[model samples]
Target chain A: MRIAELSRRSATSIPSIKYYLREGLIPGGRTTGRNQADYDEAHVRRLRLIRALVDVGGLSIAAVRDVLAAVDNPDLPGHDLLGIAHHAVSPTPARRDPDDPRWQAAREEVVTLIGERGWLVSPCSPALDVAADAIAAMRALDQADLLSSLPTYVEAVERMAAWEVAAVLARGEPARMVEGLVTGTILGEILIGALRRLAQEAESARLQGLTAPE
Target chain B: MRIAELSRRSATSIPSIKYYLREGLIPGGRTTGRNQADYDEAHVRRLRLIRALVDVGGLSIAAVRDVLAAVDNPDLPGHDLLGIAHHAVSPTPARRDPDDPRWQAAREEVVTLIGERGWLVSPCSPALDVAADAIAAMRALDQADLLSSLPTYVEAVERMAAWEVAAVLARGEPARMVEGLVTGTILGEILIGALRRLAQEAESARLQGLTAPE
Candidate 1:
């Protein structure tokens, strides 16, 4: 296949495919002549993965590069690969003042949630700080009562996470499993976020006795 | 209280409060003397809300203003108020070509899911498209098998959304309820995302026989 067919098959633009090649996000194609190259199924898959990370997952180009590097490293353990993918996708919380009492309290609350769930998470996972940051925001905003929902949220996500891990591991092939990890990590968030909003809308309508639009 | 006091209480800068005032995101303080104004506790709360929406919620200034307008409206129904807030906070998916079969298939899948769940969501809710966009991406990436998780995701979110709506309604005052709705909707996403990552880490560790860090 030529670059044109690669772009068409991958649903990516020609310019983007070229840009990705230049950025080393995707490998170069076999050059057969001047300004001519032949792409293969691998290129198509790579382009799609890159676009998924950027478009659906909302990862930065640099983050995408880092995630792809992790996926490409054959020596990296599966668990470590997931860590890199997660770190790349997770938000970099604005540094908080360590002495802020609310922050400290929220951090403890997050740790307690983990303990109660019997989740074997690393103490240093950036997600710890990210979750604490949100909890702190809830406290700062004086919505402390909403914290009660944390247990439900934790329980729900625990099951979902297990299902996700099983699905990724089921892929068998290393490359396929890594692709699944990146896609599941990023797109799963989008899926959850959007579905939550839809459910919220439905719930609100139910509470208000409002009918669906015609 | 003066602007300084308002700033200190809200943990926002004077310049930011001024910007909020200038942008009409918050109300003007009572003019006291030359270059001096008396700001009340309301000012502090409003500033905090503005910062929460901007910094934590990642809402654009214009969107924040629109959301504030909805919040400040005296006659808006609770359901309508929630509708506006959800729309404001939701991502505007890049417009899809309607004729694309994959996009069409994904959109119908979303509609079918809503029907299967008996959710009374408005047809025009942007979340419908947002969710559809994510599904389309999955199909495009050839990871359609992941779509099987939709039922689980939908069920979990339905329960969570019910709790969210109930919590917001329990706030009593319209203003407080609106505040709860916005805070819960936005921060809830951050909370869920981060928590999901933490859970995935724990699940991955369990699956790979990896030990928690010492």
Candidate 2:
């Protein structure tokens, strides 16, 4: 089909389609004449997938390419796609300030940790790293805030990490890892609902002068 | 005795103190002598409060300034720093795209609905409006990757919205809002863990050829 037809069908623009082809994000269509080219189902599917990952999932072009390549490779597990999707959809990591020593230290740790996990973290997320660094730097001045509440915050992150680790370990279907990751995304929201309600009940109890831990 | 003393006492560096002053993030120090400025107990307390909101509470400098101003104004809720803090620390709303008609439509609905529900959503979140618009644009795509998954995504965002609402209702002290917002920020992560575990169990039971659901 023509570029405009494909664009309307795929929800991508004509120029974007040409760019994707040029970038090899999608394969070039067969040349039928000087200006005409033929695109098939594969091209359509690929374009749609690209849009979903980039436009919907907020993945960068590079990340989408890497993920699609993995998805197309038969040897790759579906879990890899989930990992990429998670990386894309997760909060953009804090950036690191170039002059900040604390940012430098945190960057090293985050890079090491993410690499060791063998997950597809974006190399471009220096912003999230620096944001975290700014956060860390502020702690020294605001020790009161950290000291007063950090045990709770740490406890919370730790609990979440434990829950994640535990969930990853529980498997059955050969695609358990894939299911686990997808389910994790969905169930994560539900658990927040549960926690919020629980916390609210605890707080209301405390406000009414009821005796129980809030 | 001077800015340096206040700095030493608060664990803030002289540079950060200066930055805060220059940015008008924190109030200026009272003049002492030819080359110094003096601050007292109130300054110390106010600075501590500012640090708490910016650091642990994760508010931007502008947002922090606005909230602090509200705290000082008699026309606002004088005793409800905690509730005010909730708005201060809420994530920057998603951006809306001006070029996209579908997105513009979605944001209009979001604005009307938020007002109808009486939620004090900020009108300044052009970014959030765009994001919500982008998400709406994706929904309009009608492809499987997006269309099939949107119900779940909406479920997730709605769940997040519920957490926001519940956290406000659940607080005994105003500080709970900060704690709850921080806690809720990771609520998605928590849900991810729980859902993975639960889905795995369900799948495992099926693999074991267990009893069918009634």
* Worst lDDT 10-window in candidate 1 chain B: B172-181
Label model 1 with its docking quality class: medium
- Weakest 10 consecutive residues of candidate 1 chain A by summed lDDT: A89-98
Go through the candidates in order and give each one's C-alpha lDDT: 0.83, 0.49
User: What interface RMSD does each of the candidate structures achieve?
Assistant: 1.4, 11.5
Model 2, global lDDT? 0.49
Best by lDDT: 1
lDDT tens readout by residue for model 1, A7-51: 899899999998998998988999999999999999987887787
lDDT of 2 by residue, B1-214 (tens): 5887877776667887788888876666677767678788666656666666665566788887777666565554322443455445546435545677776775665555434433333355332343354346545543213223333333333434444434444553333344444334333233333233333333333333455334
Residue lDDT tens for model 1, B49-73: 7776776667899888787887788
Q: What is candidate 1's TM-score against the reference?
A: 0.87
| Model 1 misplacement above 4 A | A12-39, A54-69, A72-75, A98-101, A212-214, B16-39, B58-66
**Quick one: best TM-score, which candidate?**
1
